[model samples]
Target: MRTLAERAGVSSATISLALRGHPRISAATRRRILRLAEQLGYRPDPSIAKLMLHLRTRRPPGFQSLLAALTTVPEAEEQPYLRELRRSAQARAEALGYGLTVLRVAADAARRPDLERMLRARGVDGILLLPMAAPREFRPLLDWRKFSVVSATNAVLAPQFHRVVPHQFSNALLLCEELTRRGYRRLGLVMNSRHDLTVGHGPSAAVVWQNMLGGTERVMPLIFDPAGAGDLREWFERERPDAIIAEGADNAQDIARQLGLRVPGPVGFVTTNRSGPSVFAGIEERPDEIGAAAIRLLTSLIQHGEKGIPKVPTVTMVAGAWVEGRSVRAPSRAAPRKAATA
Candidate 1:
């Protein structure tokens, strides 16, 4: 401690304070101390850390520990949900007295071995994964057995980690009900075949079940892929849906334009995954709340020393809220309702 303090030109007491993430120490000093600690190959002893943690239990918790959030840079066609998830996780972790380190996926993949060693050395015992499209893209980057892991969404397919994702079934039901209440009976669902699987086919189930009810029309979900939506026009003609619920606003708009239809006019359109604000009425799946919930679950796992995949993995799903826009007609006389809860 004294040596690291001397190297950083700070007192031993300051070094200890910085190591524990004491608020009294300036942020600049804490960063420099941690950087120096890393550069000098200073690995904290787990036994001492546990002992200190035990000692501090009676008092208000100080800096509890450090966690790392693995995230990716968004692509041109991608939504900002993953980034927002990581940001929310970071904020919640800090508020709970746990420091968070943000690590990029593409940038860190090449030197993963060194990264692994560094994380273990720095006592980063928890990982909050925020992969954008597919978690498979991140599987090869690290050995997961060493740390307590939590994901921001169900996007993790390969070896499913404990995750907090939006409750797609609940969101779909909410969307279907809201659309129906707005005087739309013939409703059709459109989703890429690949996306539907990733989300566990929640929307498809909702569409099928809703159409079976008293006041709705039967419209089978059109599941397409990147190869092409070759039969989209054919499907639309056959279904003649009054309103369409789609995965992407842009994709739906493209198809709608080809069909010579006006959105929110003779035909209404809604999206299941609406990112940010737009001229579309749909469900805004709250990734921020998902991230925060993941952090909360992860901290519990870490405190209990539960590392690696559990015997029976559990999922925590957050409910999404409805966002209104000009893409759909106004609701009938009955008042607007709050977001769904499940």
Candidate 2:
């Protein structure tokens, strides 16, 4: 910085302000300072800036403030699951005497320079990424050593990074096993193929279903496509599965009716995520618990000045609960009869 300022014929403070693009510095002087800094190979130290910020800001005692960044494309609104997870995390943070700030990274901010600048300027101590539909391609862009980070879902697979997510594979296996125990042999899976491809969670569930079937032809895969309901109908008719495990109960019920199958009798259903008001049998991935755990981990890292990937990072898995509903029926129940006489 000294050499750059001398070469630019400006005071050291002027050079610092210009290099940082402070509004007080004239644009022409800023350009000159940047060019001189480049000639001298000057790089601003982030640690120094962090120390300065700490000295300037007088934080209240026992207060641990952190930034929870949600890296998504611009215009991404809060979905139901994300809203619930954020609420749980925020509530937990408050209980622990910490302040939580949510940040959304725009698509253009994925670039390295922009991301680093934003994080450093904000002085974020930690970050918690919400579940993303696809793995973000910005892992290598930022300096991970500056802040602690935790992904809310297994959708992002960064080795040696702490992750908190539900045990999806085990949940699927347990769901299938329970259905088999209840004498539902011919079971089928209905899911959105696009969602599966984006997150790789669907394939894990499929593997569990296949194992539960014991190499038999009792397992069927019925992928849903909004533009191709006719194809789905044909597949359902030909498969004729006695029971269906679907992600959404209402959609599954409607499809079952379209195939001339009576619910809880000729065809049974189970919801993968019981999101709506009605209760249904399925796995409840305890997202709220996962969110709270992530915040706790982040706090630990911040308190210890631990950053980047831990040398021995750990993964925490919260098992899903089996919720029983009226959609499923035991095989011993009598078959459905025609409409009763008036």
Candidate 3:
């Protein structure tokens, strides 16, 4: 410590705090100290660090370390995506020598007090917020200073902390380009307004960006109201899109059939969410991977004693991969022309 402090021209105390990512230390100084430490091949011994933590905390000898999976509802009522998220989080936490606990925040006014009391009593070291379909802000009632926290959902809008989520924009771009390569010229994206907003408008914007790149007439997105009677035939006749990208390829195929259009014969379809059967060519947003990444980030924050809302929150995005299905196939333009002539 003395050697590093002398080389970095900082007091030994400052060097110690900077190495531990203490919030009181300036970020610039921290970086400089870390760079110097790396250059000098200086590393902290884990055994000593653990011993120091034990001495400081004076935790019960048999107490098991724990991490919390914070959610809005119980696991049984959670959506399939959220269930996968929780499952993966639990697996990762267990592997890291910590038990995972699911705590659902009640919707009532007494939520904050009860939740905070339980967390405090359990001595949770970190928290992982599960993803939600609708955007939300973490309740301000709970004291955030107690534990390191991370959200796995982009739906969180306030008290910005570090988050892990799907790379929606890049995933949409990849899907669009792949569809174009399959000879889909007039491609259209179908999404409800709420779904568009929930994903931060990534899918809608991706389609528009792709249209600009090709200098082609932009096939305006089909934004339908979920509650209203969405007339797919009317939109198809007006837009004349060669392919449609939506949440469900099966439903898109059904809509085409109802309009006397053959799937993959005249119009191709792609799905964004592949929760059930792989009947559509689309992107698979891997919720499991997102959950694992969130746990990893949360553990790092806990290790470095990072807590509360970060001044500059960082987002880590996991890119989804394309799943090929029978709903979309290579376009046969020549065959179509021949059939038209015949």
By TM-score, the candidates rank as 1, 3, 2
Name the top lDDT candidate: 1
TM-score of each: 0.75, 0.67, 0.74
The lDDT per prediction is: 0.79, 0.65, 0.76
Clashes of each: 0, 0, 0
Q: Which candidate wins on TM-score?
A: 1
Superposed Cα deviation of residue 241, candidate 1 (Å): 1.0
Residue-wise lDDT of candidate 1 within 1-342, one digit each (tens)? 889988998788898878876546765777788899999999888999899778876575568788998755544534667667778898889777798997766633444888899899998979987755542445667788888899875556645788888889899989888897788998899887777876878888888888987369888778887667558888988988898888867866886788888875778899888887677888888988988899989987775556787778888888888889898989887745545545
lDDT of 2 by residue, 1-342 (tens): 788767877788887667655445655677677777787788879999788657645553355465655656333555555677788888877776677877666543244767677777866778887766455454665677777878776655553478787666666665665565566767777776654543346434554455454443555576665545546677777877666777666766777677766665656777665554553577766778878998887776665456787788777877777777777765343433222111
Which portions of model 3 show Cα errors greater than 4 Å?
Answer: 1-64, 73-79, 106-111, 225-231, 248-265, 331-342
The residue-level lDDT of candidate 2 at 242 comes to 64
- Taking all chains together, the TM-score of candidate 2 against the true structure is 0.67
Tell me model 2's lDDT, rounded to 2 decimals.
Answer: 0.65
Q: Model 2 RMSD to the real structure? A: 13.2
Candidate 1 steric clashes: 0
Report the C-alpha lDDT of model 3 over 207-232, residue by residue, as the tens digit. Answer: 88877675445797888776786777
